[model samples]
Target: MSTLLLSQDQVKELFTMKDIVEICEKTFQGFGEGTVINPTKVNLDLGETAAFPPYKGFMNAMPAYIGWTDIAGIKWAGGNLGERKRLGLPYVTSLIMLIDPKVGNFIAVMDGAFITNMRTGAQTAVALKYIFNNGSSEKKPIKLGLYGAGMQGHTQTLAISELFDIEEVRVYDVMKAAAEKYKKDMKDVVKGEIVVCDTPKEAAKGDAIVCVTQSKDKFLLDKWVKPGTVIFPMGSYQECDDAMLMNADKIIVDHIGQCLHRGALAELSEQGKITEDDIFGTIGELAAGKLSVGDYSDGKIVCIPIGTGAMDIAVASIAYKKAKEKGIGGTYSFV
Candidate 1:
């Protein structure tokens, strides 16, 4: 027996944003139905010195088993915002190891950064399918507000474009150049106007708002968020003000436990401002046909996705199979 090795570019080539969204939808549905085991990721914090001061980074071990796919995998995912950014590299880097369910042997290892970015965006798409569109195939014109014009921002735009007719996309980054780059790069990708905003407030005025920044402090204020907007904060630290949580008409998460551990609402959870009960429901539940967001259409909504290992596994498993069938990757024999 041998294990196949797939590179990041190879993995990216194996799936499109649409393919990823579909896979993530199935994964979430199965997760909500209790057909998947997604454990809380274990984080190993490397204090501020790992990067520049005030910007600590971490590595996490995320493991999961998708019963429907009959595959088990673990992703070694980590990032250092300051250090990597200083070197002009991606803030996050990851590798996934896939295991055969029956033999308990490692079968493949693949680059996980692409999977991570696409799956994270796909997660929001899945949530929108049920929460915003109510699981309908009909597309609506959407104006999207985005904070942090980075890779995730790009992917988020691509994923959302698959489901909605993007009427406009407003983007803001601390660096004006970054926002301009996003506009230039995405102008052709999104069949809509891509506006580079001068301020976060300007960017926050759309149908839906997405924050993918690495800010340790809050930049997205509650006042900036208009009513009838869905906010997706995908960073590890809190980007939105506590009022965004306290005043949101409904708060949905990919996983409740993960929401408490890290991501947008972790501090609020730690401070007892909100608890699991405060959450309306998980995206998985909504995707599973157990809950609906139709009642909250006119109100402000927030969906916090920490990104799950099952999603990584689902995409990775399929990539591995495709690699083997096409003889695309190098293999290391173990027998």
Candidate 2:
């Protein structure tokens, strides 16, 4: 059997945010319609203070075979925050393996980081497209407030900025240097001014707020948000406080069932701030036009996405196909 190997840079050039958005929208629709089979991701965690704790982390392998499409793959990723810092690199590293269902052979191996970021940003943008009224004059050029300046934050800003007619972007991070650097990096990519904010509160007052921090503790307050604003928290599991969830007029998640298990929703639900009935709907239902978000004038709306491996598999499948068509990746024979 011949296997294809793709580099990170090669995959990066082939898949754009727009492409990932389309894939995610379709995948989510399939998921909502009960057409997709995605099992719970398996997690194997290494203790906090292991000998090589920095290199020791959980490995999550998500396996799925889409019925609608002739694609099957698994996304394998591991997190090592301390090792990343020590090596001056990103915290999470991933790889995706695409397999041919008919032959049961390894088709390709590609970088999963790019897929992770793009799908995540695309999913968030899809949620916004469904939740917010695009035609309403009152909502044009949505004001965006952003926290955190890492990969997720940067790509999230890029994806949302392209989908919405954003008027301005207010950014904040604990590290002022990182925030400034992010602002500088996004200067040409964004049409609006990327102004650095002095505090998190300052960044949370716009029409839309996105928190992408890695903080384990809550950094945002519910009282700071105004009515008609939508908040997308993409940070750690417990990035937002209970007050934020309590004050929300509607709470939507990418996957309601999964969010209830591991994301911010789980944290809030555990605190008794919200219940199953409190969930308005999943982004997929809204994207498929099965549901509508009426007037959000009463309070804020929150959409939380816990990363999904299906997304990685989908994006990687696309990349793998393209690489083969263009004769990009080197081919090897495994006997």
Best candidate according to lDDT: 1
Instruction: Please write out the lDDT profile of model 1 over residues 159-258, one tens digit for every residue.
Output: 9888888889889999999899999988877788988889878988887898998888888999877788898988888898888889999999988888
Q: What C-alpha lDDT do the candidate models reach, one value each?
A: 0.87, 0.77
**What's the true lDDT of residue 214 in model 1?**
83
> How many pairs of residues collide in each model?
0, 0
Query: Which pairs, if any, clash in model 2?
Result: none
Off by over 4 Å in 1: 48-55
Q: After superposition, how far is residue 284 of candidate 2 from its true place, in Å?
A: 1.0
Q: What is the lDDT of residue 84 in candidate 1?
A: 80
RMSD of 2: 2.7
Please, what are the lDDT tens digits per residue for candidate 2 over residues 1-335? 88899988999889777788778777777767766667877665553325644454566787777655667889888666666668888777889988888888998888887788778788877677777753222334677888888887788877776577777889999999999999888887667788899988888778788888777778878878888988988764667788888778888887665677666777767776678889988776776667788888877898887777667777788888888788798878876
RMSD of 1: 1.9
Q: Which one wins on TM-score?
A: 1
Candidate 2 TM-score, C-alpha based: 0.91
Q: How well does each candidate superpose onto the true structure, as a TM-score?
A: 0.95, 0.91
